[model samples]
Target: MTPSIAGACGTRLIAQVLIAATVFSGTAARAQESVQTFPVAPSYPAAMPASPLGASVSALLDHARTTNPAFAAQRAETAAARERIESAGALPDPNFQVELMDFTNTMRGGGTTLLPGQVGETRYRIIQPLPGWGKRELQSRAAGAKADQAAAGLDAAWLDLATEIKNAWLRYYTADREAALARESLALLGGLEEAMLARYRQGLAPQQAVLRAQRELTSQRLAQVGIEQRRRGAAAALNGLLARAPDAPLATPADPAALPAALELPALVARARARNPALTADERGIEAARLERERTWADRYPDFSMGLTNNRPRGESQSWDLMFEVMIPLQQSARRAREREAEHMLAAADARRDATGSRLAGEIGAAYANFTSGQETQRLIRSTLLPQARATRDATRAAFETGRADFDAVLEAERQLVDTRMALLQAEVESRMALFELEKLVGDAL
Candidate 1:
């Protein structure tokens, strides 16, 4: 064979070997990453067995509902609203009165009677005010609608609390993962530094490689410090949700469970329509306004009062009298004003309901999009980018050991791997958070 042809064949064979090695390294790195678990303290508790972070979330929510003053206040308001219904339907209390009339004192020859039995005509009366026809019923309906609105408000408060807790928890999880990854990368860089120093001592690698590795290790350590700070802040925020002291310790699940399957958007929107608490509250407001308008119309009629009287005159038989009274609704202008106010209020409630529904739909759409995109990105990173970065890192390290590549190339590859891993973690956390938000918007679990 010609010399030039042999040289070309040799070069091609080396290239093939490198390519094969690269592929093998990638496969190995992917296997390693799949089995890798973040560092956990021996005393740390195991994650709850059921749903992903379900136990922790439930405990937090229970604490907020039971101990949080805001939640308690909302519940109290709901109870008060419910009590008003009975008051709205009840009749006015009966009034009682007593009168003395036609009493006379007679004196003859400077003599006065000690007692004059039944000398005065005494009268006793009781009166009861009755609401106009259908007025009390209308009032009761309005009150009931208000109670429903209050109940919906309570539900909304609960949902908000739960969402807040979930968000804080997710943030903590992300920060924790970031810290763990930084620590792992630092440890890896430390090992590399030791290897580089050994190689330097043997005069095989330059002193600069050791210094570069040390610098990278220091950077990773600094990053870990920042991550720890973030993790602490996130934990404190979560503690606040649980109504605990800011520095209270919290245990998060070690494994961020897999992403949930995508839900149908139409189904979610429909469910939200039926179950969203804010929308329900707006609907109740509309009903209450309508009922109030009806009540105002009923108020245009006159109310009535009935009375019973007992009377006794001096030397006369006891007598009973019946009396009826009516209230004239003479203030037509005021009644019309009230009716107009109620009509406007009803229209305002309807407009608010429409706005709320639109806002909710938009929120659902955004959350769903975020979740879906995060899921896809996470999958891509885990299945492709992460493995590729790891493979490049391994290949670069091997090439550097063989004097075929520079230390800078190895460092860059390692950095890429770290970044890919962090991105995957972030995407996973974001996906989970988006799911929580979506569930909250839908008013039910997926």
Candidate 2:
């Protein structure tokens, strides 16, 4: 009986173990099934982040100033030039030296009373160089002018960077809007294709209509792809210019809202002439060159060095002697050559300044004209063409549904409408870019 009981208990233990093992295995399988496996594929949507329309112009300018290599380099140069101004005005440190004198005498000289020697004399001397009248002031002015020129260069760089960033941002937004328009066209084409297929099935249209619709859809699709590719390429290029990663996704901005009212050409020109950093920089260049030429001649007058020498006699009967020396300018050939070179350089600088001024004026005029033209064009498109085109598309669609028009007519109407909208968007973008260019030339409106 005890043996039977033992066998029964053993069987129960084995059953419990098997039950536990089955439950654990089932749970493991369930967990495995619950885990999801993803494929190793690059996803465009995953890489893209949500960016709303209309980024800030101020932010873009800030980014350009901070990131642009040319701007950074110019800023560094300006700082270095400022440091040079301090160095240029500083006086040379005084030099000090010590000398020891000793005499070796023979027995006959030591015993003889002809000349007695003190044996040795120690001396200390200091030499200081003093600049001539107005020399230090000239040097200081020249260095200050150079520093000012560098500062002007830095300002120009900042203006240029802001302008470039604005233009690139406009182009990027334009491409994005164009891509959106292309996608809308593709959708319209798809709808047309569906209509054409339906007509063919009903034996109301020929195979040619279906083929035509298919071809149009494919073309629209290709166009959408091309526009998207262009957008991406433009974004990458802008990012490169801004010193950002090429793969960083760009955010599309909304169309510029409105134009600045009371646009006066004369006022803009005057502002640009006065405020433009490029013109100011050129002006500073002319001054710097003139000063540089003066410095060449001024430096030709050799710097004066005064030295005082103390001579200590070996004999007690001899007194100490003092000698003073001065160095004179003697290299006439080198000085004349440098002077002539500086004069020629000054002339060249003046001529260059004039040429730059004329070019800057022309650029300002061109940018102003473009801005005004874009504003008018955008106004016309917005206030007239776009509305008319949209109304025409609606009418055509209604007429076609009522059998008063055909598919071809509706398609043409839709194309006109889409084109008009896109054209307006482009005009707005172009106007903003032109305004940016104008502002760059003018330095700042505020």
Which candidate leads in TM-score?
1
Each candidate's TM vs. the true structure?
0.83, 0.76
lDDT of 2 at 226: 86
lDDT of 1 at 194: 63
Which lDDT tens digits does candidate 2 get at residues 1-446? 23223344444443343344334433432332222111111100122223331253445555555677877888898999989987787777867655545534342244323222333544556677766656677677878887888887788777666666666666676677677667656756666666556545545456887787788788888888888887788778778777888878655553344456546667776887787777787777778778778777777565655555454555444344344445576888888898898899889878887887787778878988887888788778767996687678767766654447776787788778777776776666666666667677667742
Clashing pairs in 1: none
lDDT per residue (tens digit) for residues 156-237 in model 1: 8888877887777777767876776676677567656666665555555667777888888888888889999998998888
Query: Which is the leading candidate under lDDT?
Result: 1
